[model samples]
Target: MALLDYWVLAAYMLGIVLIGVFYAKRNRSAQDMFAAGGQAPWWVSGLSGFMTMFSAGTFVVWGGIAYKYGMVAVSINLCYGIAALAAGYFVAGRWKTMGVDTPAEYIELRFGKSVVQLYTWAMLVYRIVGTGVALYALSIILVALMPLPEGNPFRDPNTGNLAVEWAILAFGLVVIIYTMAGGLWAVLMTDVLQFIVLNLSVLFVLVFMLQAIGGVGTFIEQAPAQFFAPVSEGYSLYFLMGWVCIHFFMVGADWAFAQRFISVPSAKEARKSAYLFGILYLVSPLVWLMPPMLYRVIDPSADPEQAYIAACLSVLPAGLVGLLIAAMFSATASLASSQLNVFAGVFTENFYRPLMERRGGSGNLVTVGRWITLLIGLLLIAVAISIPYLGGAEKVIVSVTSLMVGPLFAPTVWGIFSRRLSARAVWSCVLLTFAIGGAFKWLLSLPADGSISPSTLAWLTKHSAVIELGIGILVPLSVLALFTFVIDRNGTPGWIPDRSKNATSNAGAMASDLPARVVAVAMGLCALLLMLIALISHERQLEIGLFALVTSGISAAIYLLGTRTKIAPEFQRAL
Candidate 1:
């Protein structure tokens, strides 16, 4: 990377911080800080939900699969679409209808305070570890692209970049600042900005790649036949289906996602937001994952985990390379910020507020929330350094996440629609299924060493993902079914409290065009930035110029539309 590229990265980081400062004043209370005061547009909320599902993992993990396994990578991502669509129809709207500020409140209402305690700590620990892994994964990418001087003490002897520990801390502090300053609104707005950067990067790189390789047809004809296959050896059809099931629980019940569902104004809007998320997932993955697959044709021997970055570095110009890298970091930071905001909200609302006997909220709620954000941010940095990727441990951690998500949240989702289900069912399914899964995995699954061949061992490793998913999901659901239908036939309706807003309250608030205007300005500025880069670059002028031109045209149209959008008199006054 050149000095211009580093300048672009520096400018991008500064812009993100400015955005956080811009939104900071709007947050006056913990509710406004954490929940957007129930004012976020459906599209913004939906887009935010989509981005939260991404991280450095998308580049490192999924992109690695795309490079090695082919269409299965896109196939795996498509499950998020199916899972999200299902959630929109059955689950997302229900979460909105429950009308709680946080998912913990809903758990407490449906089960009890004890379940709330259990779920909060469980989710907090889960997300903290996951976020740390994500941070560590991001440093892996950055170090490959931007290594430090060989003699610098901070530089890693292996890869020569600032050691992963320092890189993780730097990223963590950036997340903490923006999240603490602007809260969810900052998180939401940055998500929108990152979406723009990511897709623009995708569009530009795809065009350049297609040009260099002759065209789409040439690349496809040249690619390995396996690249087009729906399923591969290890990522089989069963694994694909299991991926869908796991994310259904994730999209519908995980607090980071559920927060989006509950942040919207009404049940109907919640459905729309989730539907938008689903539709984007369905359409976007093909475009998003194709670059790595194309890179396989260019350099099949490239490290799988570094394939996406390697592809971008090959096609994108100097400043644009920095922009693309910035976008990737933005993806990881946005996800971490979402989790940070969520646990902070949970701590502030469920733990701290209640302990102070001020469950109604307090004067220092926002202040307290920011402090919690900082604490968790530090914890994430610590955990990132402790967790090492020895013997491809990152992949192991990814698989663990998939296995654990299914069992952890399946019962919570089941309770959403089933009033007859009780707290006992949640506890039973989680603990019992975990025990059985551990026994089968460690005890029964292992056979005498002479009984297993190398080929069989590899096959088992590949196929075990699906089996673990099956046990995690089926065991919990079966337990819930047994308890509800056979064991506890006399159970009463679970108390699903009504914290929902009245229809009259919603009728008084008209839709605002602020989100549209926000998008317009964001796109317009991005185009201008691209054009500036185009002027400075001496090579590939046509390729870069076309991208800038099309982007600017779209920005202009969005701005015009936003300007003409008429607000009701009362709503205008309110905004």
Candidate 2:
């Protein structure tokens, strides 16, 4: 890396720390610490949602998947966008309407304290592991980007990379400082900035890669046929079906993303945020995956996961490489900070506050929240350091998270949407699914080193886990639905809204006007134009850059116009 690159990265790290410090004064209480005092602008929340979902994994692992597996990877990812849109249209409004600081509080309101407590502990563990894996993934990229001596102590081989371990600690400390300082307010602001940098950096790589490969037509002609297929050789129909189901449930109930819904000013703004997230999802994959896909055409034998780094080194100038690296780091930090804040909220609001109330302790809740944030950040660093020893960071992270959260999906979704399903029935379903899912994951994890028959092993390897996940979700939901029917025959279902907490009124409530409508239409057309130009244009570099600029400009204009409208009192307070 060049000296200029180092300077750029240093500046970004410093800037993020300052942003966190800048927002520190805003967190006067636990409520503000956790949910931005429930007055965040819709666009801020929307961008944060996008950044949280588009983690380091999207830049590295998903790019690798696209490089190796072809367009099927793209198809699979679109499931997330589809799920987000569905949630925006249906589930987001309800979450905002509930007006809770944490998903656990909402769970408590719907069920009871005991269930919420259990769910909180479970989610805490899940997020700690998840954030640790994200940090570990980012460390891998940083290790690749940085210059280390050949015999440096941080380059161990036998028990995973020591450089990765050091990188994790360094990145974790930075994330902890800011996240512990500003809470969710800092997270949203930094996320908006990070989203812009990462998206632009990705576009930079895409344009350069297209230029290097001659053009889009040349890329197509040189790439393997499988790279263009929607359903390639290794990906089975059952896997795709299962992937879609898991994503829908995951997005609908994701705690980190749901925090964005809770932070927005109103149910209507929450819904708008979701729609905005969906629009970004539609366009981002093209820019994110194209460089890696093109890299495969150039060097078919290269590591797919490392394609992004290789392209950066090959195509970008000195300072921009550092900028791209910073963008990657920013992606991971944004996610880790969000996770840390959410974990702090769940632990402080759901767990610690209740304990204090029981004992009649007069502890300052904001102070307690900050302490918990630091604690979670430390735990995440420890988990990240330990992840290297687990082998194959990507695979382990994905398998463990999927196994742990698969069971929670059905109960969470049903609990939110269905009036007939009782809390007791949901609890019963959760336990049953946990047991069965655990056993199924164990079975799938069993050694396949030719101990089993070839055909049976192939089938088991390809389909069992996805099929298991499908079963994990479906069987529990079916049982709950049936139980609800049997118990509530001819009587009103147990879907009564809790009347104790007041819901916030809709903010900036107005019918869409000419400029707003035009901007929306123009945004869609710009996205389509980007896709069309990338597909057909011979001057790939110039056209791709133009598309990126136009898309970004239009998006900025839309945001500025939205800000100029008659502002609600709640939104004004947030500002």
Candidate 3:
């Protein structure tokens, strides 16, 4: 990266930290810090959830797959959309309808405190490692961009970039700082910022890439026959179907996503938020994933993992490349911060608050929450630095999310509807399912090394993703079904709420407009920065200026649209 790019990247990071600091003052209590105090509009919560689902995995892992395996990468991502849409329809409104402040609260309510404790610790460990894998992915991109001299102490000879350890340390610290400072409100606003930046930046990448490749139709005509196939060995049609089910359990019951569902005012708003998230995912993947696929044509020998960013660095002018990298940071930061906030909330509400002999004020508990956030952040950093030794980011991500989601979350999701599922049965079924899945996915699979003869079970090894997923989804639910039907079935359904009341928000008119106006001004500033750089350099001035003009136009449109939603002055005064 050029000196200008470094400056741009630094400014973006600093801006993110400042956003956390800005939101910090508004967080007077743990509820405000962790729950948005239920003031977030549906769109804000929805956009935040959408951005939280992104990280460097979207680029490095899926983009690499796109470069190598054709359309399968997009297919894998589309699974998230399909799953989220299902979540919107089946479970998003139910979260609000249950009237729970936190998913853990619901867990404790239905299954008792022991189950909540078990679920909390288990998921905290699970999600922290997942976040670590994401940070590891981002570190790969960063280390690639910042190359080092051969003899430099931090230099990595293999890639001639900074060492992964140092990259992980530096990036992890930045995420931790912002998460500790900003809390969940900061997470929501920054996510919205990332949503805009990522979309606008990728559109620019698509434009440039298409221009370079002549056209989509021309590229398609000249491409290999298999370039557009939607299935591959590891990502077959069965895997995709199973993938949808895994994410359904994930989005519907996972604390981070469920937090988004309950952060809104009403059940209707919660469903609306999830629908918007699903809709965005449905449309955005093809556009965003195209750069890497097109890059496969541009340079077939290019390293697949770096293909997405490489396409941008190769095609985009300097300032915009920096902007795109910053946008990538926004993606990783959004996910990391959201996870941190959710985990902190779980610790505070489920464990720390309950155990206190004399409960401090909510503000004091908020301080305790910050401390817990720091502790988890430290562990996440430790895990990220160790990711290379643990068989790389891709393996860890696929193995964990696929092999564990069903066994861990399915029972929890089912408990929302079934009263016959006792705590003992839940534990028995989840642990038993894990043992079965571990055997299928890990213990019984061919060893990672050139191990016990390749011909022993090549087909089983080839299709392990689908197998693990099938067991993960089917095992726990099947056991639970048996327990409910064949074993015991004589209780009222657990405290199910029949209807959700419309909530009167404590936030007045100005507060209602906060998210939109903040996002608009952020967009305008980013646009101004791009135009200024293009003006100073006088290279690709037209493209950059036009991009800026369109971006600023969107900014104005959002701000004006926000004005329409503000309550009339008298109404605000009445409140």
Candidate 4:
């Protein structure tokens, strides 16, 4: 890395650490630590929520996927906007009304302790594994670009540099410490700042990429037409629906996302914040994809990741590059800290402390939460270290997370909206989904020697996991519904919630004249203007620069207006 780059990165780290230290001093209780005292402005929570879900994985891997498959990769990310809207529209109010700190608590209240415990188990798996993936991706970028010593252990001859590995570990440790120390306050606060950095850097790099690629027309001419088509490999409408359904269920039910709801002041604010989040989430992918897409069009033979790294390095000056690097690290830290925080909260509130003590007060549980944070951090470190041995970075994340969505999604969805399903049905569907999904993947992995026709089995082989997942969800839900019908032979079903109580919510008067519609229209107009400039302009750099200016200006304007007017009250109260 350049000297300026190092300086910029150092400043970035210093800034984040100072922020964490500031929050650490204020983290006196579990509520302050875990929920940020529900005082986060809708803008802060909403933007950070967008960044937390987007992360480096989406930028790096999804970009690579875009390079290979065109726009089909967007199908995955578009799910977030759809999911966020659903959550904002429906689940946010319920989460606020329940007033539970974690999803496991909701599960326990709605189902039983055993079920909550199961959810906690799933959460632990999710946190450690997810951290491993994030760590792996971060390591790849840092190691590839940063300068290092000879024979460094972290460096692989076939790969890049080992110094980068140590850098990743060191950075991760710092994140764990702050997360463990400051709790959610540290995570959320740092995440908001990081989101700003990430967005700015992404915009900067995207503009540079378009300039390098000549123009939008040239890029489009050289790039695959399919790159703009946001459909999955199977090329079926069902795949899109399935993708949307899975994310809608997962994000709505996920503790990681739902905790934000609890951390907001009221149900109405949470809903408003979540609705705002949908727009922010939709824009995140475009930031990173511009570079990768341009790289594919400009230098089709180039490594996708390398292209992204080069784009940043070549386009951004040394100090700014360092800032971008810091931004990248900050992004990873934000995610890691959030994961660690949520994991601890879920474990203490729903698992270890509950199972250990029947009547323990909040104090005892809070103490347990602290210990779980440390423990989860250590486990994540171990997993992060092992990520290199797992072969390709992106493949592992998509594969592990993919299995989760297909099987877990439907039941979670069913449980929330329709409470008729019993624990038996839930477990049955989960197991059945896993079995079928796994089987489908196994079958698709066959004919591995390139014997299969590229056209017929191309999509199936490419997305065998998705197919199995589809079957897994479908079979289990169908069987469970059938089984539920048979078991209700006596004309009386079990475990249904009282309709009146189930519908009740603490939804107060939402802030009237929410600017969501106006902001949407403004952003849409800005996007249209940029597209026109990009299409009509003759100069490549001018087109991209103009596009960047418009997109960023609109995004910044919306955020500023939202924060100052509607969202500031929440943040000031929290402070």
Candidate 5:
């Protein structure tokens, strides 16, 4: 049965790659490859952005986090949603207008080529390492889901462990081939399909868990109060600081999420996407978490990875487990495909393309990007194989990403909002954020091995990641503000002039005719209402069925109208 599941996964992955190859012809120009001609509908781009950010690891890892840490995990997710909204409202216009192929290009525009070069290197390092970690998690999930038969050649000879590494390697190779062939067009288009598969899988599993656990009442009865609490475990000042750091990371440095700005047809659509995603993203996590929660109810001592697989397998009927695991693999592919594509984009636009342009032939930029994808994929496979040996894979992954986010977000935000700030200020802020944020995060590490003193843990239980993210955002902004004020007491100089011009030209700024403020307010209100529902549902303050109905109704109405208003143009064009 498990082998059958693995075979199905391989077949499904191959089908996705073939689709990419078929669409490669449509991506003739670099613009088409990079931004899908900025033609994708608001909902498509919006959902893709949401789904891409909803990496497969989010469910498995976050579910585990929720199982272990309780509401703190949800707090972190809420922080991410806010970060996404902030980006949509404020920063995305400049990015969309710049018409740049990659985020590192923004660095070049704001500062000098040297700063751009430095940022490019930094981004490559951060993304590649992060991708490796993501790949490792994906592989671990697969190994857990589809166990290889004993004495099979696919099992490692030395330890008799299943060689999921090879399966992961094959999956990576297929993704790289398709991504390199089709670029962003293929990536975004396939992302649409992948998103559907993932969401259906999520919905299916959630329904199964709810039913198997004897509905919401039984599930809640079996679980601890903290299991449903989103703000309990992360309520401390220190943890609050951590949440701030995390928020900055998501809002600022996450080029993976930020890249959506370039894919949308206009800024109106971008914000619409953000608003829609804020709600859609809320439900997406439940797919991965609910099952684990159900599993934990069954076997309290089951490790997180084990619990995730077990819940998925047990809740899903026998034949469906294979299809569901393949769906999980599709989720993995969706994530890996995007990351590898972005890494390639960054390398080509920031590093190889420039170097090749200076020297002569730019033809090989694509070739080099393909090679980079292949190399990154292999390194990730190595990382995946070694995750089992790591003392604390999850903590290490989260901490490393958290520490690196400060440098990325600080300079980008400073450059965008404050035009007069000199390149020197930008450089200074980057160094300072790296130093301060990194130091603060390391020094105030949260129970390095997930163990905290009861009082300290109790404090964390009350505060959460949002509060930590607040500190992270404030500290960097404070540093930037201090330097900006001192350097140019009058205010930011070159930033505003360029920004004004960019805003006028950028597609996102074309919303000048709409009731911008009204729409913005409406979006905010809807987001707030949904968030309240999420929190209320968590606390079980209202009837579960009623709350779900209200939440779904509001979400559906907003999405339908928002789709017509913001997405219809692109849809018409595509048709």
Candidate 6:
């Protein structure tokens, strides 16, 4: 990288820190630190949600998949939009209506403190591993794209080069500092900026790549046969279906995404934010995957995961290359920051605060939260460094997350929707799923060349994580349903508390604010402008134009209706 490139990257990193420092004073309490004081505009929360979900893995693993497998990769990713829409319709509003600061708090409210503690511990582990994997993936890309200085001794003797480890530690520290300083407010605000930068970088790369590849027609002509196939030998229709199911459960139940729902200003805004997230999922993939897909045709035998970085280095100018690198870093940082914030919330709210008898003042709680955030960041750095010992970063990440979260999904969903499911039943189901899924995952992780039987090895190897995820969901739900019928025959009468009365009182005291409405309108206009740019530059004019028009119209309507109407009493009570 050039000196100018370094300067651009440094400026980007500094800018993120400044944003966090600017928001630091606003987080005067635990709620503000964890949930942005529940004052985030719908659009800000929506953009954050989108960025949180769009981790660095999108550019690395998913881009690689697109490079190698073609449209099938895109087809699978579209499941994200489906999941977002489902959450908007079914989960987001309810989460906001409950008015809890963290998902663990909501879980505790519905179930009990024991279950809440269990969930928090599980999430702490999951977030550490998940964030570490993201950091590791981005670090690998950075190491490949940005050369190290001469005679640098950072390289590990055993690993050949420890550039990945150094990169992880360096960037991870930056993320930790900013996240600890500003909390959720900083995360959301910086996410908005990162989203803009990353999308622009994607557009920039896509334009240059298409030109380099001799336009869309030549690019398509040079693509392999499977480039157009939605499903094939390894990735079958069953895999796609399983992937869709996993995403639906994961998106709806995952605490990181749920945090966004709870942090939005109102239940209505939560739902609207989800809709906006879905819109981004629908539109952004076109640009995100294009360069990598084109790179497949350019160098069929290259490491597929490096396609995006390779494209950037090959096509972009020096300063722009740095910007692209910053964008990649932004993806990693946004995701890591969100996870760190959520981790702090879970540890402090569900475990520390309650166990200590709520002894601390708000400032003390926030201080503790910041400390926990810093600790989690350090743990993630260690995890990232250790990732080189793991065979495949992407595979390990997917498998571990699926194994951990798969069991939690059914219980979380049922707990929210079904009064018939007793706490005992939920606990039993969770324990059973953990035992079974963990064993299955462990077996799957074992070396195929070992003493295991051929048939067993084949079953484990052929099924993939998606299929295991399906089993994880199905078995737990099945067990829970059976227990619900036999053990809780009468159901837990009035299982849901009468929060309505309290909610109504809270609602009466608060009024719908106008700033959120204005932000929503502004966001809609930005989306329309993005779509207009797409319509003019890309081949799919009709599709892009329609998307822009619809987004603009809906945004305008939302603003008009928001200004005229009062906040729903139930939603206000939730606040």
Better by lDDT, candidate 5 or 3: 3
Report how far residue 408 has shifted in candidate 4, in Å: 2.7
User: How high is each candidate's TM-score?
Assistant: 0.93, 0.85, 0.93, 0.81, 0.78, 0.85
Task: Report every candidate's CA lDDT.
Answer: 0.81, 0.73, 0.81, 0.66, 0.60, 0.75
* Global local distance difference test of model 1: 0.81
Write candidate 2's Cα lDDT for 267-303 as tens digits.
7788988888877877777677777788888888888
Quality of model 3 by C-alpha lDDT: 0.81
**Cα lDDT for residue 383, candidate 6:** 87
* Per-residue lDDT value at 307 in model 2: 75
Expressed as tens digits, the lDDT of each residue in 311-411 for candidate 1 is 88888878898888788888888789999999899889878888777545355888899999999889988888777743354456555666578667887
> Which candidate ranks first by TM-score, i.e. highest?
1
Regions more than 4 Å wrong, model 4: 151-160, 232-236, 355-367, 392-395, 446-466, 483-575
Over the stretch 42-124, how does candidate 6's per-residue lDDT look in tens digits? 77788898898767777888888888888877877776787788878888887877767898887888877778777777777
TM-score rank order: 1, 3, 2, 6, 4, 5
lDDT, candidate 5, 3-122, per-residue tens = 444454555576668767766776665555656666655666666676676555675677677666555666666665666666667666556666566676766766768777666667
As a whole number from 0 to 100, the lDDT of residue 128 in candidate 6 is 75
Higher-scoring candidate on lDDT, 3 or 4: 3
Residue 179 in candidate 5, Cα distance off native in Å: 0.8
Write the number of the candidate with greater lDDT, choosing between 2 and 5: 2
Clashing pairs in 6: none
Give the alpha carbon lDDT tens digit for every residue of 1-575 in model 4.
77656655765676666666666766666667787766565665676677677555665777677676666666666777888888788887667666666666667766677666666776677667777777767777777766456676666666545554576677777887777767777777677667656765777677667766676888888877667876755544665666666667666767777888777767667787788778765766555566766677766776765666655766664445665776778677877888888888777665665566665544555567778888888788778777667666566565565567645555655666654566666677767766766776676666746766657567677665466446745676685676556753343344443445423532332332223333434344435434443454444546445655666676667656556655565534332
Q: Where in model 5 is the C-alpha error above 4 Å?
A: 69-71, 145-151, 158-161, 234-245, 364-368, 386-391, 437-471, 490-492, 495-575
